[model samples]
Target chain A: MKNKIIAFFLGLLILSFAACKKDVAQDQYEVNPVKLYPSIGAKNKNKTQEQYVSILYTNLFQRALSGNQLVEIIDCLESIGDKELGREVLISNFMNDPQVVLPSDSVMRANPDVFTEQTYERFFVRKPSEAEKTWFRNFIEANPQLSAEMIYFAFALSNEYLYY
Target chain B: MNRRKFIRNAGIAGAGAFAVPYILPSGRLFAATGRQLAGHVVYVLFAGGVRQQESILQRYLDDSQGFPWAGNIMYNMFNGPSPENKIVYGTNQGNGVEGGTPIPQILSQTLETQGTVFREVQAQSAGHFGGLNNLLQGSQVTTQGLKQKPINPTIFEYLRRHGGFPASKVWFVGNGIGNGLPLLNYSNHPNYGSQYGANFFAPSITFGNLGFEHLSNAKVYHPENELDPMYQMKYFLDQSFANVGKGGDSLGNTEDEKQDIKSFMRSTYDRVTQNAIPFPTITENNDALNIGFACEIMRWFKPAITVVNLSSVDGCHADFTGYLRALHRADHAVGHLWNYIQTQIPEMAGDTVLIASPECGRNLNHNPIKDVNDWYAYDHSDNNASRVFTVMAGPGVPQNLSIGNEANPVGFTSDNVPTIGEILGVKDEIMGAGFLQPESVSLFDRI
Candidate 1:
């Protein structure tokens, strides 16, 4: 009789424990969807004349351009109708300046990968993809006569450089 | 091989030939609908407020300053005699009087004798910018603001889009980049914008001291070894960006055209340094300098349409004496430009059409501002400002014909756009576009 009473008590205790158990919800922290731009082309806005000159001067000289110099450059650009041609001439003029900083051809030839990465970073302000890097590497390797200045010129005059 | 087969094939081929239109270089399916009156046109926006009393009227000081002097200062453009006394609209000759010696005529025959002149044409606007817009857009947008791009498609856009003229083929040589002159090269219209815009050059700023300091020192890369690779890389980059859409506006000059323009710029710089520009004999103002560059452009490009803007006479608001001198020099500049086209550019000698018209006329009465000569200055903002003139000379234009008079006005300032359209074989398209002013019609039609 005692054994039967103890079993009944134990059954009740188990029932109580089972009834007290709570359901655990799946862990799913909600977040809003994010739009991402995966390539260098994410930069879509065109740089104004002032912005272009100022940034270009900074890139070449590794320093800021003076206000007066910036205005003069903008004026020179305004004089020409074709903005690309104007920028081309202005860049060439800057290339001719002794103060312009550029990596030596030997340094560029030693590691085109590094040179291209830095160029992309400097002008486009983006990291190049593997394909882009490989293409530039092969181009630099194949063309023995190509100089660092030419590479910079190409980057500076590229359509990508015109935009942000 | 058989007669029936041959006949069928020939008929089919003929039908195909007739049906399939030839594509022009400008990507047009066919040539302009209307007959091309001239191969080239040189339209001069005789801008800046010009007083009809001082210009077409041949009334010098008599009409303005109460002095008993009356004559034509613009002898090159009009058929009239110079003033007998109080001659103060010419180069100074150190005779203790400013503008004592009149500038000699550059044109052997006056433009009035060579072409048709609309003596009392109605200008759409009294303001300078508005008047300029009327001349360029062929319509007057009442809400057009200053320092803004044209509200409608310009003649440059019309000629380029309809006439299929390349960007390089159409040119706008501005006197300076002030007063929205540069903006007039193209319009902000969605359908016809920079793609069909004229290639502009404000030469005073381009080849001036500022340009010399900045643009003169460009490095000339070898076309094959340097420029080719650079272009290849740039094209690759552009291709990558093309997926994202166009990043900036383009004037639609091809690579070859860009190279040609660059070459021209280099040559121009050399010419500027050597003082070899074909300047007018009395190149004492910015207008004359502008004409010199326009001549250079004509000599080099032989563009299909070239519009030169002259605005030195705008000084009339502050200096009447300066206004007279500038007007006189402007006449000389126009004469020099015409002479240069005839004598210097053999390709455009007989085929080119030359048209000149003032934007607006100055006020009838003078302002309080007076010059050292006690001459009163005039501002444009009255009914008198609506009175202007148009003169055109070229093939298909009736020679020595004069239309309209002070008592009976007979044309609109906006007529020049259609007039140019008629000359360039795009009159039907321009009229069909319906952007013109209500009264605007070809000057030829008026004639």
Candidate 2:
């Protein structure tokens, strides 16, 4: 009887050992991507004349415009009926000013990816998608004569710039 | 292929080419139906507020100031002798008198003899803005407000939307931007809005000191290399944004037209510096300057229609002597404009129609205000303000004919729009729109 009890206890111990075997060595990697805007659809409101002039002056000069100068600029814009042509002329006039700040062409060409990303953020207030970034980088690399001033001009005159 | 089969195919192709309806740029499947009278039309909203006593009536000071001087000061537009005694409505030759030397007439023949004149016409509005609206919109909506666009389509829209005229072919030149002069280029009507608006220029602000300081230094971008790439980038950005909404309304001027306009602005700036604008002999006032710019615009664009607004004579509310001087100068300006078209512009010579009318008339009675000459001033806003006149001259207008004497008024100021439409071969389209004043009709029909 003693021998039978010992054997039965031994079988119970073997069953417990088989049932408690270690869990499989599975690994997990937490994925949390930084959130970004999907598209430009969120910006819907149009900027007023004052807002446009003020923001444009600040963007180019890194300073705020005075009230009297703002009025004069508005007058210049109002004198023209075609708002697009008016903006073109006004931007060219600003570019002609000696104080207009722009980076050198060599700097832009050396690190196109960084320059383009910064430009997109400065003007559009958003990061460019991979496709947009790649397209711009290719465009800049192809055209050696293109200047930062011209790119800035294009951005300032863009239809997207007219809205907030 | 056999010769007989080739001939049959050629005939079929020719027939199809003629029978099939082609669409115009304005999206119309057919061309205008009315017969065009002239290739161009120049409508002048003659000085702000002219008095019948001083203008068409030729009463001069006899009717306004109780003086014995009774003669026409607008000899270029009317046929009458100048006042021999008190010749104060001319340039001051540094004499003790303020105005002593009258400007010589510009036209060999007066407009009254050259074409038909409506001696007395009814003005729909006593106010300046409303009267101007009547002349352009051909409708006097009681709800029309100041400083707002017209409620109905203007002649510019009618010609562009129905007549298929391009934006560069229509223009409105204002003396200044004040008094809502810029708003007259387009209307708020949903059917015909900004896409068909005229290209407007308030030259006093556009080409004056302000323009010189701002617009004279535009950079000339290369068409193939620079501008092409820039425009491509802009288009991409626009497409991205357009997925949501449009940015702003455009006047529908093609890129080529916009470039041409920029070139014109550059040349005008150079001309101003050289004192080469075609100004009248007595170019002392804003009216003369405005007309000079109008002449330049016509010379450049050869537009289908050009409307020039002159308002210097509005000073008459406080100065009668100044009013007379301005009236004489206004006549000189008109004479210069007509003479310029015939002599300077070969394309428009003898083919353009000239129409002129005052927005409203001044009060028959003088106000309490007195000028430096001790003469009483006149203000508008009475029954007399509704009394106005219209003068038409050009190819299809009747010569040496005068209708509607002071006692028998014949036409309304709103008739000018339909008259312009008739001249441009879009009268049927405009009349069918059902937006014009009920009584409005072509002046030719009136004849």
- lDDT measured at residue A9 in model 2 versus the true structure, 0 to 100: 96
Native contacts kept (model 2): 0.60
Which residue ranges in model 2 land beyond 4 Å of their true spot? A1-39, B1-20, B94-96
In candidate 1, what are the lDDT values of residues B182-288, reduced to their tens digit? Answer: 78888999989888889988899889988888888888899999999988888877787777656456788998898899899899999999999999998899999
- The ten-residue window of minimal lDDT in model 2 chain B covers B240-249
Q: What DockQ does each listed candidate score?
A: 0.42, 0.42
Model 2, position A95, has a per-residue lDDT of: 85
In TM-score terms, candidate 2 sits at: 0.89
- The chain B TM-scores of all candidates, as shown, are 0.95, 0.95
Clashing pairs in model 1, backbone N/Cα/C closer than 3 A: none
State each model's CA lDDT, in order: 0.89, 0.89
lDDT of 2 at B242: 78
Docking band of candidate 2:
acceptable
